[model samples]
Target: MKKSIFGILTFILFSMNTFAQNTVAEEIKTLSKDKWQWMADKDVDKLGKLFDDQSMFVHMGGSWGKERELEIIKTGFIHYKKADIHEVFTPIIIENTVILLNRITLFAVVANTEVSNPFMVTEVYVKVGNEWKMGSLSFSKLMGPN
Candidate 1:
């Protein structure tokens, strides 16, 4: 009788944990998509809020801090035309940190020309005071055809 009660309690706890993790994963996934849309729209204000103060962005061209990244978006230095997301992988959540990986074909305008490239984008988010702020964004260029 005692063993049966303990087993039920353990199952309940495990189910709750799984549900919480799934919820976090879905929330982060939505945030990731919103980020791409904000970039394409050049919504600097929203992006600024979503990005952590000390966030780092790594591009094929170079890497920079939050300010420079926001500036680039605001000024259309490299216009993010589209993010054709192929897949959003399950996030790896550890306490206050979450790492989300996405496979996408990104379209951008650079030097007055439009270019599309396949990339694996890594988005790192950290929870702060009930909000999740992007801490890092790194893009890895994929070889071969998109």
Candidate 2:
């Protein structure tokens, strides 16, 4: 009876661990898609919610603050009439409380000077308490026809 009880407890613990990993993976996917949607709609406030207070963005041009990124959307320096994100791949790496999300986002800009640029992106997330906060996000442009 004790052996059976131990086996059940072990099974439960393993199941919980698997569930946690799956949940984090799903959250990463959702956040990634939401980011593209926010960019397309130029939603600065929504975008701000996804970033950490100390979030740093390194664009193809250079680096910028999370606030600065929001400002660009607010000021209309970057505008997207419609941006379709395709061929997205997200890989999650978890080490205790730290999670790393690697993504490849292929997108076509419906409007803007920078159009048809496909990107392979990487983002890092840190689990702070019960919340998963994005610590760092970066991207590289892929050379191809878009």
Candidate 3:
């Protein structure tokens, strides 16, 4: 009887832990989706808050830190006109960090020239205290159609 009771308790504990992780993952997904919109709109204020102080951004042109990225967006240097998300892969959570990949077709204006490209965007978010902050964002160009 004790063994059976112990087994049930263990299963219950495991299930609850899984549910909590799933909830956190869902929150991360929602935040990522909102981030895309914020980028499109060039909402620097919100982006500034989402991004960590030591955040890094990688692009086809080059890589930069949070301040430079914000400057680029604010000045219309690389206007993220739109992002058509093709797929959002399952996020991998490791303790307080989450890594997510998104396949997307990005339409943007760079140097006053409009262009579109397929890319795999990788985003890393780290939970700090009770909030999640973006630590890294990278764009890898894909050779294919949208």
Candidate 4:
């Protein structure tokens, strides 16, 4: 009787943990999707709250921190006109941090010239207090068509 009860309790605990993990993963996925839209809209106020103070952004041209990135977006220097997302892979969670990879075709204007390019965008989110803040955003251009 004791062994049976213990086994059942262990199974229940494991199931609950798994469900919680899945829930968090889905939340992060939704947050990432919203982030893309925010970038397109140039909504710095919203983006600022989502991004960590020391967050880093990496691009083909250069790498910069949160404030500079927000400034660039606000100024329309590199307008994120649109993002054609191909896939958003399941995120890997390490304690309080989640790492997600997104395959997308980005449409944007740089130097007043419009361009479209396939890219694998890596996004890292860190849980802060009760909220999740973006810790890093990096773009890796993919070869050929998606």
Candidate 5:
């Protein structure tokens, strides 16, 4: 009876740990998609909420911080008519108090620039407390259909 009870407890603990890990992965994916959604829609307020005060964003030609990203959004440098994200995949890495989330996002650029560019991107996220924050992002421009 003692051995049986101990086995059950171990199983439960293992299950709980697995569930918790899955939950973190889901949250990371949601945050990844939300970040892109905010960018495509130029939803500055939503985007602002996602960034850490010290976060930095480096794009093709320039780099920006939380405020700078918001500023560009306000200036209409990026405009979005419709955004379609495909093949979104996020992988999670946990280290002590810090969780690292890396994802590949393939999207369509609906507006903004005249030149054709790749929409596929990689985003890095770090967990702080109970929330995950974006740390770095990089994108590649693909040749659009002629």
Candidate 6:
């Protein structure tokens, strides 16, 4: 019957859309994990490509632009030692923008001393010509034990 066919088509379309969203979420999640590793390793070149030219980064100490962020990583001003990711939630805000929320225990070396802290990191990625570039990174310090 016509109704039965229409129902099937609708279900198929909905399923496909859900699948695509999941795919994008997974891709962004992987990229986020890779970004943590790259930061730990001080891979500025890779980070530069992943970060948009006008990207903004907000840290507990201060906020800065993409170039300054990269420079800090390169100069060991705030070396990322490790990121113990507790959870990652990726939500597609629009067709071209995805917001990734990461709960993590971040270890870093600052002033030649090691420190660990819990943080909720918000990362916004925007699609640009078939590539996703990080547009913003904001770290919110979490209270209590790390």
TM-score of each: 0.97, 0.76, 0.96, 0.97, 0.70, 0.95
- Report how far off residue 47 is in candidate 2 (Å): 1.4
Candidate 4 residue pairs that clash: none
lDDT of 4 at 121: 98
Give candidate 2 misplaced runs (Cα > 4 Å). Answer: 1-3, 80-83, 88-90, 95-114, 144-146
Across residues 1-146, which tens digit of lDDT does each residue of candidate 3 receive?
99999999999999999998899889998999999899889999999999999999999999999999999999999999999999999899999999999999999999899999999999999998899999999999999676
> Looking at model 2, how many pairs of residues clash?
0
Q: Which ten residues in a row have the lowest lDDT in candidate 2?
A: 102-111
Q: What clash pairs does model 6 have?
A: none
- After superposition, which runs of candidate 5 have C-alpha atoms over 4 Å from their true positions? 1-6, 80-83, 96-112, 141-146
Candidate 2, residues 65-144, lDDT tens digits: the string is 78887887776666644435555454555563444334344343322565545565667766667666667767678786
The regions of model 4 sitting more than 4 angstroms off are none
lDDT of 5 at 56: 80
Candidate with the greatest lDDT versus the true structure: 4
How well is each residue in 1-146 modelled by candidate 6, as lDDT tens digits? 99999999999999999999999999999999999999999999999999999999999888999999999999999899999999887575688999999999999998788999899999999999999999999999999765
Better of 4 and 6 by TM-score: 4
lDDT, candidate 1, at 146: 58
**Higher lDDT: candidate 3 or 5?**
3
Model 4 lDDT at residue 101: 97
